[model samples]
Target: MKQAKTPFQFMAASTLTRICGVQATNISELLEQLRRVSTDSVFNHTFQSLSAYHFLTEGFSNDFAQWALAACNAPQMAEQLAALDIRQYESVEDLRADLVQTLESFVAAEPQRAQQKAFEPFYFCEAVTVTVPTDWRAHNLREFCEALWHVSVHSIHYHFVSARLRGPQTNDFSAWMEHSLGLPELADRVEHIDIYTNTLERVRQLILDECIPWVES
Candidate 1:
């Protein structure tokens, strides 16, 4: 088995949620707040939402989509928001721009929807993440798979979904696999896991499944 050129240190993370003191009761308010809110806030609502509600079996994948449907009674707008493919965005600013544009288009088409009151106000929030090193470090593919099985789902989210905004690589695991282990095909498979469709636990399992054959080979 090929050993990694550099050992991959496993990491675990936890998020501290904070209210940014911005609230939106309707689409118009949401659009205005979204334009001015910090990138962290935009990230929290979209990317972080995957981990925050990882166990969700149904409903929209993002907070904005859920709020648009449940609170604002705008299913069409909700669908549009939910349809955003977060993987396409390399930065939070791009994600925020797309979010704003989606709402802008919706509001323009149905101006009455802008004034519609939500059942509960949408409070903009941001996540303060604290990532710490774990004792589980992998020098090879087999060790990596074993350590991955033992890490918390939060760790999976941190390395997989959240890492997209932090660097040029697709994710921590894929990058290490391709660059450190010289396994581009396996890395690409790991990177292609559809985060939007699967729960975090499911994501962890899928990653493990992908690594199994490579480990045995």
Candidate 2:
């Protein structure tokens, strides 16, 4: 019988240690037998944690691409991501850089920016009129991206909060958004708190790992 491969480690010494050029039968042996390897053995716990954050940020960016493609039929961005092999991004900063580049390319190819139109088209029964863009532009890419990210994060937060607060009865985005952001709120709703915590944690990780490194560079 053959031995099974180990489950992928979220944190694995083997991950960094396993080199392609090494001549060894097993990962463990490869690490042990290798000589004269250039290893930077800095015990910067903060830096490692920051790397994890960058990984998560890239993960989130991938997720966002999927969502955008599904919701808006904008498969170009997603296709570009896959073509770029962004999943193999060496570091968090690399992932962030690629994501920004992908967005920029997409925007640059667009002939025009989506002018703010009446929010009436998107407004459902519970949705209030909020002017929204139908498409994205590359020129003012950063500002557009900021708005896109803000809406998505808050949208999820509101959705979760509504599910907990309004029971199973509420079925639409409008109702959920209103109730979630509405007046007197209670402590029992786990969705709002949980989602916010998770999202912020992800954001903080991205900033430390991806943003800081890029800024320093």
Per-candidate TM vs. native?
A: 0.97, 0.26
Worst 10 residues of 2 by lDDT: 6-15
Best by TM-score: 1
lDDT of 2 by residue, 1-217 (tens): 1111221111112113222343322212222322222222111111222233332433323333443344434566556643443213334344445545665655556524212121222110111212233332212223322433444332332332222232443322223223432311221232123222244345423322322322233
Which regions of candidate 2 are displaced past 4 Å? 1-61, 111-217
**1-217, model 1: which lDDT tens digit per residue?**
8999999998888888999999999899999999999988898898888888988748998899999999998998899999998877789998999999999998898888797888999999998878899999999999999999999888988888878788755999999999999999999999999987788899989999999998888
Shift in Å, residue 72, candidate 2:
2.3
Best by the lDDT measure? 1
Please list all clashing residue pairs in model 1, or write none if there are none.
Answer: none
